[model samples]
Target: MATKTDDPKVLAQNRKANHDYFIEDTVEAGIVLTGTEIKSIRQGKANLRDSFVRIQSGEAWLINCHISHFEHGNRFNVDPTRTRKLLLHRTQIDKLFGQMKEKSYALVPLKIYLKNGFAKVLLGLAKGKKNYDKRQDVAKKDAQRDIDRALRDRQKY
Candidate 1:
Protein backbone atom coordinates (compact mmCIF):
# COMPACT_ATOMS: atom_id res chain seq x y z
CA MET A 1 0.00 0.00 0.00
CA ALA A 2 1.25 3.46 -0.83
CA THR A 3 1.69 5.85 2.10
CA LYS A 4 0.46 9.41 2.01
CA THR A 5 2.78 12.22 2.96
CA ASP A 6 -0.13 14.11 4.51
CA ASP A 7 -0.83 11.56 7.26
CA PRO A 8 1.21 13.45 9.80
CA LYS A 9 2.55 11.68 12.84
CA VAL A 10 2.25 14.83 14.87
CA LEU A 11 -0.63 16.64 13.27
CA ALA A 12 -0.39 19.91 15.13
CA GLN A 13 1.61 21.53 17.93
CA ASN A 14 1.49 24.56 20.21
CA ARG A 15 5.06 25.75 20.69
CA LYS A 16 4.04 29.08 22.19
CA ALA A 17 2.61 27.33 25.24
CA ASN A 18 6.10 26.43 26.39
CA HIS A 19 7.34 30.01 26.24
CA ASP A 20 4.20 31.39 27.92
CA TYR A 21 3.78 28.87 30.74
CA PHE A 22 5.64 26.59 33.12
CA ILE A 23 4.30 23.12 32.45
CA GLU A 24 3.97 21.31 35.76
CA ASP A 25 2.40 18.12 34.45
CA THR A 26 1.09 16.54 31.26
CA VAL A 27 -1.68 14.14 30.30
CA GLU A 28 -2.48 12.25 27.13
CA ALA A 29 -6.09 12.56 26.07
CA GLY A 30 -8.20 11.14 23.26
CA ILE A 31 -10.08 13.62 21.16
CA VAL A 32 -13.56 13.29 19.72
CA LEU A 33 -13.65 13.91 16.00
CA THR A 34 -16.00 13.57 13.09
CA GLY A 35 -15.20 11.58 9.96
CA THR A 36 -14.25 14.66 8.04
CA GLU A 37 -12.33 16.08 10.96
CA ILE A 38 -10.08 13.06 11.15
CA LYS A 39 -9.51 13.17 7.40
CA SER A 40 -8.60 16.83 7.66
CA ILE A 41 -6.18 16.12 10.48
CA ARG A 42 -4.57 13.33 8.51
CA GLN A 43 -4.04 15.87 5.76
CA GLY A 44 -1.94 17.91 8.21
CA LYS A 45 -4.44 20.75 8.20
CA ALA A 46 -5.02 21.04 11.91
CA ASN A 47 -3.81 23.83 14.19
CA LEU A 48 -3.37 23.57 17.96
CA ARG A 49 -2.24 27.11 18.59
CA ASP A 50 -4.40 29.10 21.03
CA SER A 51 -6.33 25.99 21.99
CA PHE A 52 -7.09 25.14 25.60
CA VAL A 53 -8.84 22.52 27.73
CA ARG A 54 -11.54 23.16 30.28
CA ILE A 55 -13.53 20.98 32.66
CA GLN A 56 -17.21 21.83 32.88
CA SER A 57 -19.97 19.80 34.52
CA GLY A 58 -17.47 17.04 34.97
CA GLU A 59 -16.58 16.95 31.27
CA ALA A 60 -13.35 17.98 29.61
CA TRP A 61 -13.75 20.22 26.58
CA LEU A 62 -11.25 21.33 23.99
CA ILE A 63 -11.78 24.85 22.75
CA ASN A 64 -10.40 27.09 20.04
CA CYS A 65 -8.69 24.35 18.04
CA HIS A 66 -9.02 24.46 14.28
CA ILE A 67 -9.20 21.53 11.92
CA SER A 68 -9.61 22.41 8.30
CA HIS A 69 -12.50 21.04 6.30
CA PHE A 70 -11.92 18.00 4.16
CA GLU A 71 -11.80 18.82 0.50
CA HIS A 72 -14.17 16.02 -0.40
CA GLY A 73 -16.31 16.16 2.75
CA ASN A 74 -18.77 18.62 1.27
CA ARG A 75 -21.70 18.72 3.71
CA PHE A 76 -19.95 16.40 6.13
CA ASN A 77 -17.36 18.99 7.16
CA VAL A 78 -17.94 20.71 10.45
CA ASP A 79 -16.84 24.07 11.69
CA PRO A 80 -13.06 24.35 11.66
CA THR A 81 -12.90 26.07 15.06
CA ARG A 82 -15.77 24.30 16.81
CA THR A 83 -15.43 23.21 20.41
CA ARG A 84 -14.60 19.55 20.83
CA LYS A 85 -14.80 17.16 23.73
CA LEU A 86 -11.71 15.52 25.23
CA LEU A 87 -11.88 12.02 26.66
CA LEU A 88 -10.39 11.59 30.12
CA HIS A 89 -11.18 9.45 33.13
CA ARG A 90 -13.50 10.78 35.81
CA THR A 91 -10.79 10.93 38.48
CA GLN A 92 -8.46 12.66 36.09
CA ILE A 93 -11.08 15.20 35.18
CA ASP A 94 -11.80 15.87 38.82
CA LYS A 95 -8.14 16.33 39.58
CA LEU A 96 -7.72 18.69 36.66
CA PHE A 97 -10.76 20.66 37.69
CA GLY A 98 -9.37 21.14 41.15
CA GLN A 99 -6.03 22.20 39.81
CA MET A 100 -7.70 24.62 37.39
CA LYS A 101 -9.35 26.41 40.30
CA GLU A 102 -5.98 27.86 41.12
CA LYS A 103 -5.51 31.39 39.80
CA SER A 104 -2.30 30.77 37.90
CA TYR A 105 -2.86 27.29 36.58
CA ALA A 106 -4.13 26.79 33.04
CA LEU A 107 -4.69 23.89 30.67
CA VAL A 108 -2.93 24.14 27.34
CA PRO A 109 -2.67 21.76 24.42
CA LEU A 110 1.01 21.01 23.82
CA LYS A 111 0.60 18.79 20.78
CA ILE A 112 -1.64 16.38 18.95
CA TYR A 113 -0.56 13.12 17.37
CA LEU A 114 -2.16 10.19 15.60
CA LYS A 115 -1.64 6.96 17.52
CA ASN A 116 -3.02 3.54 16.59
CA GLY A 117 -5.43 5.19 14.16
CA PHE A 118 -6.69 7.48 16.91
CA ALA A 119 -6.08 11.13 17.60
CA LYS A 120 -4.54 12.00 20.93
CA VAL A 121 -3.59 15.30 22.45
CA LEU A 122 -0.88 16.04 24.96
CA LEU A 123 -2.35 18.37 27.55
CA GLY A 124 -0.16 20.43 29.80
CA LEU A 125 -1.04 21.58 33.30
CA ALA A 126 0.79 24.87 33.12
CA LYS A 127 1.23 27.95 35.24
CA GLY A 128 1.51 31.20 33.39
CA LYS A 129 4.94 32.80 33.42
CA LYS A 130 5.53 36.42 34.23
CA ASN A 131 7.29 38.74 31.83
CA TYR A 132 10.50 38.64 33.84
CA ASP A 133 10.29 34.87 34.09
CA LYS A 134 10.10 34.58 30.34
CA ARG A 135 13.08 36.95 29.99
CA GLN A 136 15.08 34.84 32.43
CA ASP A 137 14.29 31.68 30.45
CA VAL A 138 15.49 33.36 27.26
CA ALA A 139 18.69 34.43 28.94
CA LYS A 140 19.29 30.92 30.29
CA LYS A 141 18.78 29.39 26.86
CA ASP A 142 21.18 31.88 25.33
CA ALA A 143 23.80 31.05 27.97
CA GLN A 144 23.40 27.35 27.32
CA ARG A 145 23.81 27.85 23.60
CA ASP A 146 26.98 29.87 24.16
CA ILE A 147 28.41 27.16 26.41
CA ASP A 148 27.69 24.47 23.84
CA ARG A 149 29.33 26.52 21.08
CA ALA A 150 32.43 27.07 23.23
CA LEU A 151 32.69 23.36 23.97
CA ARG A 152 32.40 22.53 20.28
CA ASP A 153 35.13 25.07 19.39
CA ARG A 154 37.41 23.69 22.10
CA GLN A 155 36.97 20.16 20.68
CA LYS A 156 37.77 21.35 17.15
CA TYR A 157 41.07 23.03 18.18
Candidate 2:
Protein backbone atom coordinates (compact mmCIF):
# COMPACT_ATOMS: atom_id res chain seq x y z
CA MET A 1 0.00 0.00 0.00
CA ALA A 2 1.49 3.26 -1.19
CA THR A 3 0.67 6.49 0.59
CA LYS A 4 0.19 9.80 -1.20
CA THR A 5 2.64 12.51 -0.38
CA ASP A 6 2.98 16.13 -1.40
CA ASP A 7 6.41 15.26 -2.76
CA PRO A 8 5.79 12.32 -5.04
CA LYS A 9 7.72 9.19 -4.27
CA VAL A 10 8.36 7.54 -7.66
CA LEU A 11 5.81 4.78 -8.27
CA ALA A 12 7.18 3.29 -11.45
CA GLN A 13 10.06 3.96 -13.83
CA ASN A 14 10.89 2.89 -17.36
CA ARG A 15 14.31 1.36 -16.73
CA LYS A 16 14.38 -0.12 -20.24
CA ALA A 17 14.51 3.41 -21.66
CA ASN A 18 17.95 3.96 -20.14
CA HIS A 19 19.30 0.71 -21.55
CA ASP A 20 17.76 1.09 -25.02
CA TYR A 21 17.99 4.81 -25.64
CA PHE A 22 20.70 7.43 -25.39
CA ILE A 23 18.84 10.22 -23.65
CA GLU A 24 20.08 13.50 -25.07
CA ASP A 25 17.86 15.80 -23.10
CA THR A 26 15.15 15.79 -20.43
CA VAL A 27 12.19 18.00 -19.67
CA GLU A 28 9.59 17.92 -16.93
CA ALA A 29 5.96 18.34 -17.94
CA GLY A 30 2.82 18.29 -15.83
CA ILE A 31 0.11 15.76 -16.54
CA VAL A 32 -3.57 16.63 -16.66
CA LEU A 33 -5.60 14.27 -14.51
CA THR A 34 -9.10 13.83 -13.13
CA GLY A 35 -10.02 13.11 -9.54
CA THR A 36 -10.17 9.35 -9.87
CA GLU A 37 -7.00 9.26 -11.93
CA ILE A 38 -5.25 11.19 -9.23
CA LYS A 39 -6.53 8.81 -6.61
CA SER A 40 -5.37 5.79 -8.58
CA ILE A 41 -1.93 7.32 -9.05
CA ARG A 42 -1.71 7.90 -5.32
CA GLN A 43 -2.32 4.22 -4.83
CA GLY A 44 0.63 3.43 -7.11
CA LYS A 45 -1.51 1.98 -9.87
CA ALA A 46 0.29 3.44 -12.83
CA ASN A 47 2.62 2.17 -15.50
CA LEU A 48 5.22 4.18 -17.41
CA ARG A 49 6.35 1.09 -19.29
CA ASP A 50 5.46 1.13 -23.00
CA SER A 51 4.54 4.79 -22.66
CA PHE A 52 6.01 7.63 -24.76
CA VAL A 53 5.51 11.26 -25.66
CA ARG A 54 4.03 12.53 -28.88
CA ILE A 55 3.74 16.02 -30.34
CA GLN A 56 0.71 16.80 -32.45
CA SER A 57 -0.55 20.17 -33.67
CA GLY A 58 2.15 21.79 -31.55
CA GLU A 59 0.87 20.05 -28.41
CA ALA A 60 2.62 17.33 -26.41
CA TRP A 61 0.81 14.32 -24.97
CA LEU A 62 1.54 11.16 -23.01
CA ILE A 63 0.32 8.06 -24.84
CA ASN A 64 -0.07 4.40 -23.89
CA CYS A 65 0.18 5.08 -20.14
CA HIS A 66 -2.00 2.91 -17.95
CA ILE A 67 -3.45 4.58 -14.89
CA SER A 68 -5.89 2.23 -13.28
CA HIS A 69 -9.27 3.55 -12.22
CA PHE A 70 -10.05 4.19 -8.59
CA GLU A 71 -11.68 1.11 -7.19
CA HIS A 72 -14.30 2.94 -5.14
CA GLY A 73 -15.32 5.36 -7.84
CA ASN A 74 -17.78 3.73 -10.20
CA ARG A 75 -19.58 5.96 -12.71
CA PHE A 76 -17.47 8.99 -11.89
CA ASN A 77 -14.28 7.27 -13.01
CA VAL A 78 -12.50 8.36 -16.20
CA ASP A 79 -10.84 6.22 -18.81
CA PRO A 80 -7.80 4.47 -17.43
CA THR A 81 -5.63 4.55 -20.57
CA ARG A 82 -6.61 7.79 -22.20
CA THR A 83 -3.97 9.88 -23.94
CA ARG A 84 -3.35 12.70 -21.50
CA LYS A 85 -2.21 16.19 -22.38
CA LEU A 86 1.22 17.27 -21.19
CA LEU A 87 1.79 20.78 -19.95
CA LEU A 88 4.87 22.30 -21.55
CA HIS A 89 5.88 25.81 -22.50
CA ARG A 90 5.52 26.92 -26.11
CA THR A 91 9.28 27.20 -26.66
CA GLN A 92 9.91 23.74 -25.25
CA ILE A 93 7.13 22.27 -27.36
CA ASP A 94 8.56 23.87 -30.48
CA LYS A 95 12.05 22.61 -29.74
CA LEU A 96 10.75 19.09 -29.16
CA PHE A 97 8.76 19.14 -32.39
CA GLY A 98 11.73 20.30 -34.43
CA GLN A 99 13.98 17.57 -33.09
CA MET A 100 11.30 14.91 -33.57
CA LYS A 101 11.42 15.42 -37.32
CA GLU A 102 14.83 13.81 -37.41
CA LYS A 103 15.02 10.09 -38.10
CA SER A 104 15.54 7.68 -35.17
CA TYR A 105 14.89 10.40 -32.59
CA ALA A 106 12.09 9.57 -30.16
CA LEU A 107 10.42 10.84 -27.02
CA VAL A 108 10.35 8.43 -24.09
CA PRO A 109 8.96 8.89 -20.63
CA LEU A 110 11.60 8.29 -17.95
CA LYS A 111 9.29 8.43 -14.93
CA ILE A 112 6.25 10.02 -13.36
CA TYR A 113 6.36 11.71 -10.00
CA LEU A 114 4.49 14.25 -7.95
CA LYS A 115 6.29 17.56 -7.66
CA ASN A 116 4.86 20.35 -5.55
CA GLY A 117 1.55 18.50 -5.45
CA PHE A 118 1.36 18.22 -9.24
CA ALA A 119 1.87 15.14 -11.38
CA LYS A 120 4.95 15.54 -13.55
CA VAL A 121 6.57 13.26 -16.10
CA LEU A 122 10.21 13.39 -17.07
CA LEU A 123 10.37 13.19 -20.86
CA GLY A 124 13.56 12.18 -22.59
CA LEU A 125 14.66 13.05 -26.07
CA ALA A 126 16.59 9.96 -27.02
CA LYS A 127 18.05 7.91 -29.83
CA GLY A 128 17.76 4.12 -29.82
CA LYS A 129 20.89 2.03 -29.32
CA LYS A 130 21.97 -0.80 -31.58
CA ASN A 131 22.63 -4.34 -30.41
CA TYR A 132 26.39 -3.89 -30.41
CA ASP A 133 26.07 -0.64 -28.50
CA LYS A 134 24.06 -2.32 -25.76
CA ARG A 135 26.53 -5.18 -25.55
CA GLN A 136 29.46 -2.75 -25.27
CA ASP A 137 27.69 -0.84 -22.52
CA VAL A 138 27.09 -4.05 -20.60
CA ALA A 139 30.74 -5.04 -20.95
CA LYS A 140 31.92 -1.64 -19.78
CA LYS A 141 29.68 -1.81 -16.71
CA ASP A 142 30.94 -5.30 -15.84
CA ALA A 143 34.56 -4.18 -16.16
CA GLN A 144 33.96 -1.13 -14.00
CA ARG A 145 32.25 -3.24 -11.31
CA ASP A 146 35.18 -5.70 -11.29
CA ILE A 147 37.70 -2.86 -10.98
CA ASP A 148 35.80 -1.37 -8.05
CA ARG A 149 35.67 -4.72 -6.30
CA ALA A 150 39.43 -5.32 -6.86
CA LEU A 151 40.29 -1.87 -5.41
CA ARG A 152 38.09 -2.44 -2.35
CA ASP A 153 39.65 -5.86 -1.69
CA ARG A 154 43.20 -4.48 -2.00
CA GLN A 155 42.44 -1.62 0.40
CA LYS A 156 41.21 -4.07 3.07
CA TYR A 157 43.94 -6.75 2.67
lDDT of 2 by residue, 1-157 (tens): 6555676678668999999999999998999999989888888899988998899998998999999989998998987789999999999999888888965589999988877667789899999999999999999999999999999999997
Number of the top lDDT candidate: 1
Model 1 scores what on Cα lDDT?
0.91
lDDT of each: 0.91, 0.89
Model 1 backbone overlap count? 0
Q: What is residue 4's positional error in candidate 2, in angstroms?
A: 13
Off by over 4 Å in 2: 1-8
TM-score of every model versus the real structure: 0.92, 0.90
Residue pairs in collision within model 2: none
